[model samples]
Target: MAQNHEIANEVLEAVGGRDNIASFAHCATRLRIMVNDKEKIDQNRVENIDKVKGAFFNSGQYQIIFGTGTVNQIYEEMEKMGLDGSSKEEVKSQAKQQGSGFQRAIRTFGDVFVPIIPVLVATGLFMGMRGLLTQPEILALFGMTKETISPNFLLYTQVLTDTAFAFLPALVAWSAFRVFGGSPVLGIILGLMLVNPALPNAYSVADGSAQALRFFDFIPVVGYQGSVIPAFVVGLLGAKLERFLRKRIPEALDLILTPFLTLLIMITLGLFAIGPIFHSLEEVVLNATTAVLNLPYGIAGIVIGGLHQIVVVTGVHHIFNLLEIQLLERTGANPFNAIITCAMAAQAAACLAVGLKTKDKKLKALALPSSFSAFLGITEPAIFGVNLRYMKPFVMGLIGGAAGGFLASLFHLAGTGMAITVLPGTLLYLNSQLPMYILCNGVAIAVGFVLTWVFGFSDKMLNEMKISGK
Candidate 1:
């Protein structure tokens, strides 16, 4: 605890003290600070600070990477020092005030998706495990066949794996509601109503085994299971409707009547109108994404692979999680995972090239570990710390990623899961697919390394390679 405070003090000193801070906040790993004067920042000093994993300025925020729970502790110390910290939402508001519409949209998209990844990731791993357990090779090892496998075991795995997607709307709605300053529980209720048993599961309707419940002979009530857009829209509307109801309801009846009316209206509106319209629209989007990803002869791969890390730099990469999840839900495979891994591996390789080329011990220390981390499926350290600082490396990484993605698409490689990638990505392809996954990542890393070694470093970087003797 004392050590944390000491490290916090180092950060405060490095940033030129409290008066230099315009605002301060932290995300899952980065301590995102907006300062009044970028000129006052001791960039080299901050990067060397104890407990900081990496530091970089991006999106107008000087982000000091502390990694996970440590950032929260550092922020608390800052608060105690009378630095007067701002919440992440406040930081976001300030950013929106400064950014263009497109930037704001990207930020908002990240906000919605960040809180939802863990839910999806856990579900994805479970899905992979279910596939692993049911694989014919594994079954053969256990002296069983698919038909001979225990029905009870399949039911358990299926329930664990499928429930998240089946009830995905509720989870997304709850998260969206919380983000929008609404009652999350109520948002979940509305989502559940959209996917109510009475309305019939979407699959049943698709197979013509079930019909939508007709409301007043015209409006077809339906569930939004496995849907995203409708749940998100409904969450937003539910928040607005709740606030509206609160404004008009008498204080005496507010607690009871406001919630009741809000829930009642939102639930009905969600099922009778929003669910049908938005779910169809969502399908259109999913179909469009599939088409774009399926463009002939690895063309889609070239585009997605080349530009993917650019999106990551903007922190909007989480938006792809939805696409990946939806792809897996619909087709039982995710080719995007293979492409994304390639992109990450490229950056990892770029970091390696930078580490090997730099004479500065400080720079070398930062880059090598970052490269390793990126290989292990976390790329931020490599990206923000090294490759982005040398713009050529970032571009090199992108090109490598494009090459790898093209190969992956041409090979038609797919994964059993969505979230995990890079070196750790082998776990996702346990079904005789690990070799192909390795080949894809190898292409990415080798391309990135060769390109960066040849053309990534600037004359300025080489000139500045001398470290100040401590």
Candidate 2:
């Protein structure tokens, strides 16, 4: 522990004392604070704080970088001090008003999707495991083939692989409802209604194997299996409708009538109107995204990989979960995964370069662990504490990511799963493709290290850190 009380005291004062903060939260490597007044902050003083690698305002919060494990302690310290220790939900509601229109929209998208990533990630890993167990070489070693696989094993694998995509809309709707301030239970129920077994599955409809039911002989009703847009829209509409009903429904009847009317009205609207309309729109967006991914040679790789960290900086990278899920649902593999892993590698490598070159003990201490963490598939420590602090390092990371991404795309590389990346991503490429995965990561880290060593760090930065004791 880094003397929580002292660090908390320093953090509290740097953000202009406890009174200036509207709310506080921490992600992997930063203390994100919503301040009542930006004018109160002492940016220079905060950046110079001992153990703080960097500081900046982004996504409507004055974020001070403390690197992974340290942030958790500082956040708890602030709470122990009786400051605005709001839950993530409360902070989200308050912070929504601070960003520009586009920023707010992106934030909302993140709010809705980030919470559900763990669920999908777990499912994705299971799917990858299923694929691995059934690989031709592995099966041959066991004296079995796909046809000879045990039905019991196959059945379990199907559950592991299919369950997530089958109920994806429900997950999205549940998360979206929470983000939009609706009752999460209601959102979940509504999501289930959209994908009920009684209705024709969306995939069956897409494959032209099932006929859609005609509601009132006009509207088409189908299950929203593997769907995102329909559930997301339904969540928004249901939330707004619930808020409206709660206001008009009398206090005595609040519990009963509000639930009754909200569910009845929203479920009906979702099945008849929202599902059909938005499902079409979802298809269009999916097509466009696939077209970009399928673009000639390495353009998509260079663009997506180069700019991916910028998205991380904006805190809107969670939106890519939706895209990656959609890709997995449609293509049965995520081509974006290996490319993203490469980007993460570049970030870690740049941090490692700084760790090697820095003379200041404080800077070296920060960079080494942050770099190691980044290489393990978590980049926030490296990104916020080391690379982004030196503008040139961040740009070098981008170039390295672009180079790695270009090669990944040129080779038509893809991952068997989403979520896991950098070091852990090796499991995804465990089949005969493991060497390729290593090579791609090697390309990324090498370029990032060489470029950053040459251009990102300097004697001057280390001198500043030594003098200021940063």
> TM-scores of the models, in the given order?
0.90, 0.93
lDDT of 1: 0.81
Top candidate, metric lDDT: 2
* Off by more than 4 A, model 1: 1-10, 13-16, 36-60, 66-90, 93-96, 214-218, 458-460, 464-470
Residue 156 of model 2 has an lDDT of: 91
Clashing pairs in 2: none
Task: List candidate 2 segments past 4 Å from native.
Answer: 80-84, 216-218, 464-470
- Candidate 1 per-residue lDDT, tens place, 1-470, comes to 23887888889889888888889999877899988888888887787687666787666688997765778998998888778888888877666655567766766666766677777667767777877777898989989899998889888988877887888888878878887778889888887877788778887887799897787899876667788888888898898888888889999999999789888888877887888788888899899988988889998778888999998877667678678878877877889998888998999999999998877766787788888878888788888778877688999999999989998888878886777788767767776677787888899899999999888974456455433321
